[model samples]
Target: CSNGGLEGANNGKITVPAGVTSFTITTPTVDDDLKEDTEAYSISVGGVDATGTILDNEEDIEVSSVTSDTQTEGTSLVHTVTLSGEAEAAKEYDFTFNNGTVEDEDIGTLQFSNGVTYDASTGKITVPAGVTSFTITTPTVDDDLKEDTEAYSISVGGVD
Candidate 1:
């Protein structure tokens, strides 16, 4: 009646009544928000052992957030995309520039680090291993058509 010495589980002692054939042990699931491989643990009773495996349910690349302040017209609107967890491999993502109050031409070529670049023609970016954050820069056109402040957003899409 032990917890198999697992970190996410609790240790316990169970009393088995005479003539009881079997009992149940509960293994609690832990949400660590980290991508990991399957982990195994063993439960021993009277020199006999039983093994159990915990499957990782977390995403390879955690959710991403765009961090940037309001930009002045004619300056590059730099959006820094950040991932939450450390990646074991390169993480590829697709993003799109959504127009709110700006025109399509207002967005320029998107530039990234490590020689990675994309424009309106392509919609993908790859974050290399051991990298958690990267920036994408695109110039905003300062048009003569004077209106209110233009609002736009870069929408990060599916992961690969």
Candidate 2:
């Protein structure tokens, strides 16, 4: 008794036509357990217009079972870095990262992109899924001998 129940059959359902009034149903970011009692999912909508009219709207997708307060993202999450001098052996060095507050960076550094990845043993740096912000391209070690300006420090602990 389900063709697109809970919007999970490959997530293929959402057609708007016949005057195009309005439509918007987007829900993402689900990770909060400790359920004491509260969880629901039911957004039924069968449509038909442009001569053959019929639109059913029985919406309801409430999920609120607090107890954990939502804070679980520690799959070995790591992004530690530190460097402030020592690079003048072969040349080729350029440091750029700040985090004054974010949105431009200045405090320590952090303004990543959409698809990120950096794991040198476990210094995890994977902010996948429509990344919000990320930027840490540490690569260019020449160590020739002629250094003077070196600086870097990125530390983002796991969110338990």
Candidate 3:
């Protein structure tokens, strides 16, 4: 009950003594299971003001470890990739950069340079640990003949 406690409505209630003005809640910083990354929720304290008055501002509960942002599809997408968190020892993280939708399966015709090469066998890139960021190069393609800019994404969850 102490660890992994949910303060959401119908789940649990946060109460403070009559003299107390505010209270603090605990949250997990990291997890061993990869599935437990991050979570967030909005909380609204509603009741009699005799006990404590909740703030008028929007309150949010954020539980997170790793996160990602959407990348636009383009003829040339040179992304400076940065992994999450810091590493104490030198190691490697296996990851993947997915191109197009699953139904379409279009990885585009753009070419990559330097150490950025696609591996169809393992379907992941071996990134050395302790390295926060690295460059991924892609040559521009002639989009005049193409219909539109396709979709693609990058992921780091495959890393063990």
- The Cα local distance difference test for each model comes to 0.67, 0.33, 0.42
Worst 10 residues of 3 by lDDT: 56-65
lDDT of 1: 0.67
Higher-TM-score candidate of 1 and 2:
1
Model 2 stretches astray by more than 4 angstroms: 1-40, 43-96, 99-126, 129-137, 141-145, 155-160
Residue 109 shift from truth in candidate 3, angstroms: 7.8
TM-score of candidate 2 relative to the true fold: 0.20
- lDDT of candidate 2? 0.33
Candidate number of the best TM-score: 1
Model 1 lDDT-worst window of ten: 1-10
Listed in order, each prediction's TM-score against the native is 0.54, 0.20, 0.36
Model 2: per-residue Cα lDDT over 12-131, one tens digit each: 565444555555454443443211223344555564332222222322212111111111121111232222222212111122233222222212223333445545466555544322
Model 3: per-residue Cα lDDT over 22-58, one tens digit each: 5544443443322221345444555533232222222
- lDDT, model 2, position 1: 19
